[model samples]
Target chain A: GAGVSQSPSNKVTEKGKDVELRCDPISGHTALYWYRQSLGQGLEFLIYFQGNSAPDKSGLPSDRFSAERTGGSVSTLTIQRTQQEDSAVYLCASSLTSGGAHETQYFGPGTRLLVL
Target chain B: AQSVSQHNHHVILSEAASLELGCNYSYGGTVNLFWYVQYPGQHLQLLLKYFSGDPLVKGIKGFEAEFIKSKFSFNLRKPSVQWSDTAEYFCAVRAYNNNDMRFGAGTRLTVKP
Candidate 1:
């Protein structure tokens, strides 16, 4: 089975430009999550989606950041007016389900975004 | 809000040496603990997790972690390390009922042969 996959392994964008990162979750996975990993920092939670329920947007850092999961399989994280601070690796993960103690998240290779 | 702390930023050890990485989380409610590892040029993968029962949990690659509720800690350990064990480890915590998971700053382990 193919693992979670992300598009554009690396992206370099100018500050104030918008960038979109895509993620394809594993087959049959009902829970998907997005995170940001900065140098010398921990993974920062960004957003999450579980089945047909509303997406959890509590982790989004600002209004410029948003995500959408269409048809319950693919997700795209959009960052508007990207900042230098937004330069980091964007990782996507998926699990069999959400809110279960036994669920373990499987991560993708991640898309490295560099804002100049 | 919940937060995780990883005591060591970087640790270097020789092959066959014992390994221990400290992790602690601050959360008022019941939580799930996990250790994730990232090898060079690879994606992050689960090492182990603790949800309920059996405070001690073993994971792949001879790794294990003990959950101490009293101290709010879940420290990862291995009896012996190999040169291939060199990688970055992250400690994560999530409330039993919450969807948000928090991660530590990560500890880099360097094992020499």
Candidate 2:
């Protein structure tokens, strides 16, 4: 079975440009998450999606950051007018259920975004 | 706001040596604790988790963690470590009813052969 996967393993862009990172969750998974990891730092939660309900965007750093999960299977995180501080590794994860009690999230290899 | 802390930033040990990594959380409510590991050039993988029941939980790769509710701690331990165990370890915590999860700064372990 395919695990959580993210495309564009590496991306280099200007500080003022916008970039979109994509993620494909495992089949049958109803929970998806996006996180950002700075160099030598831990994961920082960005957004979460559970089934057809509204996505949780509380973890998003700013309005410039937005994410969408279409059809409840694939997700895309877009950063508008990216700043140098936005450069980091973007990781995606998915779990079988949305319950926080026993959900074991599986992570992806991550996309390393570099803002020059 | 909830947060997680990992005391050790980096650790180095020889093969067959015992290993222990400390993890603590600030949330007072019911929270799920987890330990994840990431090997070189590999994705993060779950090492263990403590949702309920037994406080002492065993995980893959001869690893285990003890969740001490009294101290708000979930420390990971391995009696004997192998060189392959060298990797980065992260401690995470999430509230039982919330979707947001917090992670520690991570501890990098290096095992000498």
Candidate 3:
């Protein structure tokens, strides 16, 4: 409850279907981030939300991917038309503030997404 | 653009053995360094970080890392490891004033009893 919480610890869906992953960050945290960890690959930055500033979606692999943080607390990452390559561990993290010289990010038990 | 590299993909060690995992990054500007651990079936937890002050920083569970700015290296070390230490480790960094913290591939460490 105190830490970042992600829904559907595990989800398996058929290819070409859409999937939405949710993340609830710690209270008072203003900065939220989404990352993907593919098998044997590193954690890839997917998106970042800072306060009210425009989210940096530079890491989204394609236009098919998008995310939104409503009310600065709950965030969701949606993958449209999932493919085999879309299977990975979806991780969510949040920091106390969006900006600062150095801030630690608390992570959640990633949601394991599988596309069949 | 910034990226992180973990030298060893897999490392095997015996109980009480010394351990070191190398991490390097390519970034021209200032950055913050961090090491996170993920035990089997657990979420990623912060092991340590290097923001400023001492380059050689100590972290939880008797872990430590030294940030070598000139070489752009931040390596994790443990004097003695135990079987319970087996886990996946990740290194990350964020720009001097940025919100994005890029992560390294990750090193799987298995300490045998």
Best by lDDT: 1
lDDT tens digits by residue: candidate 2, B1-113: 78999999999999999999999999889988999999999999999998999999999989999999999999999999999999999999998878898999999999999
> Compared with the true structure, what per-residue lDDT tens digits does model 3 show for residues B68-111?
99999999999999999999999998887776678999999999
Q: Chain A vs. true chain A, TM-score per candidate?
A: 0.98, 0.97, 0.96
DockQ of each: 0.89, 0.82, 0.72
Q: Considering DockQ, which of the candidate structures 2 and 3 is the better prediction for this target?
A: 2
User: Which stretch of 10 consecutive residues in model 2 chain A shows the poorest summed lDDT?
Assistant: A96-105
lDDT of each: 0.96, 0.95, 0.92
The TM-score measured for candidate 2 stands at 0.98
lDDT winner between 1 and 3, please give it: 1
Q: What tens-digit string does per-residue lDDT give for candidate 1 at A1-39?
A: 899999989999999999999999999999999999999
lDDT of 3 by residue, A36-74 (tens): 999998899999998998999989999999999999889
For model 3, the stretches where C-alpha displacement exceeds 4 angstroms are A99-102
User: How many backbone overlaps does candidate 2 show?
Assistant: 0
Candidate order (DockQ): 1, 2, 3
CAPRI docking class of candidate 3 = medium
* Per-residue lDDT over B1-113 for candidate 1, one digit per residue giving the tens place of the 0 to 100 score: 89999999999999999999999999989999999999999999999998899999999999999999999999999999999999999999999878899999999999998
Local error of candidate 3 at B64, Å? 0.7
Alpha carbon lDDT at A73, candidate 3 = 89
Candidate 2 regions exceeding 4 Å error are none
